[model samples]
Target: MLRRVDSWTRTLRHAKPSSSESVRLVVERLSHEGRGVVRPGGKVGFVAGALPGESIEARLVERHRRFDEYRLLDVVEASPRRVTPACPIVERCGGCDLQHLDHDAQLDHKTAVLRELMSRTAGLEPAVPEAPLRSPPFGYRRRARLAWHVPRRGAPRLGFRQAGSREIVALAACPVLDPVLASLPGRLQPVLASLRRPRQLGHVELTVSESGDGRPWPVLYLHLVEALAAEDRARVAGFAAAEGAYLYLGLADQRAECVYRPEPQAPGYLLPESGLRLTFEPGDFLQGNAAVNRAMVRRVVEWLSGDGVRRVVDAFCGLGNFALPLAAAGLAVEGYEGDAALVDRARRNAADLGLDDRARFSVRDLDADAGLPDGVDAVLLDPPRTGAAALAAALAARPVPVVAYVSCAPATLTRDAAVLAGAGYRLERLAAVDMFPQTAHIEAMALFTR
Candidate 1:
């Protein structure tokens, strides 16, 4: 009877497809994260690297009660919008998604996602969605954080984390990064491997700032679990000197100490259009794509440049990216940020530009009931991903004539848009900003007015 029962169990197992089994599926659409959505056996499945309207064979990697996860094995039918990914390890690298999709289609996808969220969540839609703010699909990223790991055995690995994994995908080059930053990983690999305690080095962040002559001024921040030896420090300094890159050593306390500097001045980027230059220290929040940031700043100034708009409030302002420019555009701007360090930096930047009288920076906790400043004609907010629900509620109570919201997450943006709508603010203009290309991430600018 036991043998008979075992035989029946075997038969039942073969009756249906099991986990890790390959199955053919037709992708219905792309999820917000750029994963292809499908339904197999009446269960939703998310398959990475599978385009919408394509038939593909995928292996079930994970099974959950509501949805399944799949790894693409073969594409039986490919979408016309698909293209060969530029990165050889795009499949495994977590740095970028939607690389296989055409660049134009990527913009369309982002706009569609934004519209869907606004219509569904906010119950509002723009009369006309503005064209997406464009950026070069490749070599546009000005900043990158790479993970470095020294395995128990084998050469030390340095690159981005693997997709959906903590494992590091060692890279020789990354095309999406700025040209100067793209080559650093390969060159730094050997230097990191030479360290006495390589595993002590947790990660490295690379940022590229352009000099006045259009030369790349690269900065490297080395995050360490423990202090490096004098010899190791010297070796890393030697590499920085050779590359003409500024170096900062991040200690266990999360303080970055400048170890090497080729110039007396701190590294920063210029908004030539605004005739302003802003300097920032290591770990400061900066927009990754400089060109897009400039365009974004310009758009913000233009959108707020209406008659009778004399004073503006910039919330969650970091180093005065928008406030300084607005002041340059002849508006009195009050910039508020949570980080005291950033607030100080913004003030210094304003002073350097001689816009201190017009632009003032204050350190305020936006998460709390930090009421909006009075006598401000317009409000501009660029909140982090948690998305200014508290601030949105505050804005609902005290509605401004115009509110420009810069959002990185559409879901949260729509959630806040609902609050503004309740306060009788109509969605005026909405545009997708291609701030980070070759990725599923979306940045949007929305204008709301009473």
Candidate 2:
């Protein structure tokens, strides 16, 4: 069923390429998803792999009511900022988007993208400071999820899919993955080779963390499409023992029950520069990059320390990432999360950090209509890509004095920013962080003060 549907989707025909069109349209701006937005015939069209001021021939893929999406046909002319891509597989693999351009230019483009989104989507124009980018653009990804597939008659391979397709691109080594976890596919290939044909390996999850004893160890979580046999379990255990990495497997079921072998020290770990350490289970949600995450927390704390601001409410807070840090800084912080288990973990983590008295964790679904406690000096919101519409509305109704929003999605962030701006809050500052270097995923921080 899956393969047939994938094949049909792959065969869907796209619109004609812009080769004979006499009108030349220039790219005016870039979309949040890294697509170029151009106005042709007073209509908007999104061009893939395009930069502002670049004129390129693109093939239209889909025509919507408001806009159209197009694919790069040929770069008739190139932009000055455009540079040769470093990785050979960049064009094919969807792993990284901004690798073709220089890192400095990438930062500039992101800043411009955010500025456009803020001004157009929201009425206010925010000033963005020159935020630092991560060094060594390649091989920085410490975690990855790869699809497992074996050709009908050939050997099995593991990697990500091509851009805008379901076809998996087999990879021997990934430059973005951690060196130790990157070698897992090659090391485990032999063990998988012994399995029967059409073995049920769906996806592979790799995470690196430190043990309770302060020893670093990599944990590989395998989600299977079928039940594991005795030999399969043995192979996993043997691989974990040999590779010095922990192994956790999720069986295929209605709920997909996860089973961990040989006791895992921790599913994930975070060691901040401020002497705050966190350990979470495998299924818990945590920030991908640790260094930048700590920096973001510290920056937020620094911004919150002002006159008459004695208390803070962290909405959508996960595992006390912001709450504990704020508490450590001697502020009365209250953290809320939707997950009950995560809320418990946050409390435990705060207690472990000797900050339980200063910090409090509560399980509150921000999506619903929940009442806020009195005397919330400020609100720190870190919501998912859906954005915190409900929370924003509630915050606006109460008219919070300050809001520091950390968002991964520019479109949704701008939407929420407009809502807050409507309620008399003005966007004061914006900063773009290249949390995901290679990909078009841009992490931004926006501050709105009443």
TM-score of each: 0.93, 0.85
Q: What lDDT would each prediction earn against the true structure?
A: 0.87, 0.74
> Tens digits of per-residue lDDT for model 2 on 1-450?
111111111222345443434344588877767667888787898776777888766555666899976665556667777776666566667687666567777777777778788889988787545464353566556677877888787878677887666777776677766565666766776676666533777787777776555555677777877867878777776887877777777765443343443444445465555567776755567776655676688778877887877899999888988888888888999898998888988998887889999999988888884568998999999999999999888878898788999998888899999999989998888888777776678778888899
lDDT of 2: 0.74
Ten contiguous residues minimizing lDDT sum, candidate 2: 1-10
Each candidate: RMSD: 6.3, 5.5
Model 2 stretches astray by more than 4 angstroms: 1-29, 36-46, 53-77, 127-136, 196-198, 211-215, 252-264
Query: Which pairs of residues clash in candidate 1, taking residues 3 or more apart in a chain or in different chains?
Result: none
lDDT of 1 by residue, 209-307 (tens): 766555678899999988899999999999999999999999766769999987777888889898877889888999999999999999999999999
Query: In candidate 1, which residue ranges exceed 4 Å CA deviation?
Result: 1-17
Under the 3 Å rule for N, CA and C atoms, how many clashes does model 2 have?
Answer: 0
